[model samples]
Target: MASRLTQARNRVVDRMVNAPRDTDERALRRAVAGKTVLVTGASFGLGEATARTLARHGAIVLAVARTAERLDELVAAIEAEGGKAYAYPADLSDFDSIGPLADKMIAEHGGIDIVINNAGKSMRRSLDLQYDRFHDFTRMVNVNYLGPVRLLLAVLPHMRERGSGQIVNVSTIGVRIPPGPRWGVYQSTKGAFDIWLRSIAPEIKVDGIDVSTIYMTLIYTRMSAPTPSMRKLPGMSAKEASGLVTRAIIGREREITPWWVTPAQATDAVARGAVTWGMGILHRNSSDTASARGEAVR
Candidate 1:
């Protein structure tokens, strides 16, 4: 009975959070065919799916990730399907390496037509557990903020000079909703990049560059797998998440937020105090994960 009740709640939450999006394959082909597209985090989950879909539509995919073997496998799989892809294995968290990676891509491809900033890191640890781990904050900031920014800075000039490009940021819906406890590092880092991109969108618009931010909701992947509670929640599949990303590629919408988010944002604005109090109560009742508390999983 308890399990059934949990499942029922998950269904309700999924319905409220997930929105249906239609993608016209013809449109996607028209937008990306023969174009050089770069996808970060392409070794697994959503990014991997998105890269494959884009390649199927005839995009010349540049798959970027830290795992060389996985990236090679992804490229091989794309090739087997008569798609074009090249593996570029690099760590997005390493700020020093991003410039060289971007430069090499530019040098090799002449200039990229689309950039999918899909790489990210997520953490959910409370402040008490974080006091001894300053690197946690730095790691998230590096992966979620500075790294993407550095890559963009490297490629923006080339895109600007050409006067045509597209940048799709695979951001989280957490940045849109009210702040919850234990997400301070992740949320703040993601929020910083979101704001930075929005601020620069106007300046780059005149250069014929389209900027799209997909504020995505939960999708079960390795990133969320470590959290036992996330496994019980209703979320998108890899294919479903990739569809929204490809839709963003086809339509170039400035922002693709869940339909429910706007109203939730409004409610959050008006009931800020109430929301804070409720979240505080919930946080107090919840204990940190074993990993967050620096303990063994077993």
Candidate 2:
């Protein structure tokens, strides 16, 4: 009985968070056919999966990442499969280079029809451990927030001129859920971009430019590899997560979230104090355990 109840609960949760597993392949192909799509962090993980998926759907995928070799390989694989893709290697954290990159993309492809802001850095160290590492926070902010902002600013004029564009922000559930310990750097930076995107979404829609933010749950990706505990946790695969991006592209929805997310957000709002208290206890316990093992509490 207990096992059956657990199975049922999992099913409900899955339905709430997952994109419909059965996607209309032909429809998705038609939606992006001939469209020029830009995907950042395309060398690996979710970005890579999304890039390949978009390319397969007949989009002229512009794959961006820091690693030229990986990007080249990805583009080659896509082309071998009869899909259109181009490798553009650029360090997203380098704010000064974003404008030039945007220009090159526009000059080369006419303009990007969809921009997937999927590149970001994640940090999991506690604030106590970060006293000597201020760079952690700055790096997160630069990659997660400023990098996308600069790129978007550089490309907005072209999008506005065309009066049609879509910006899909790959966000995190941390932005909506109750905050967790040791995730201050990651969550704060992600939240900053989340709020900024939401603020500008209204203004852009008037010009026929759509902006969608996907508040994603944990995914099995290199980005989450640093936390060993996460490996054992139930998480989405990169391909599955990419499907949500494709769905956003097809549906042009304002926001995409796991079905249970709204209820979770409401609970977070109503039980803020309790949530904080519980997290505080968990943090304290974790610190104590580390101390007991004579290990640094990071």
What global local distance difference test value does model 2 have?
A: 0.86
Expressed as tens digits, the lDDT of each residue in 1-298 for candidate 1 is: 5698897986677667775554689999999999999999999999998999999999999999999999999999999999999999998877789899999999998999999999888888889887788888888898899999999999999999999999999989889999889989999999999999999999999999999999998898988887788877778888778888888888899988878888879989999999899999999998777777784211
* Alpha carbon deviation, residue 82, candidate 2 (Å): 0.8
- The C-alpha lDDT values of all candidates are 0.89, 0.86
Worst 10 residues of 1 by lDDT: 289-298
Candidate 2 lDDT, 25-72, residue by residue in tens: 898888899999999999999999999988988999999989999999
Model 2: weakest 10-residue lDDT segment is: 288-297
Winning model by TM-score: 1
Error of 1 at 98 (Å): 1.7
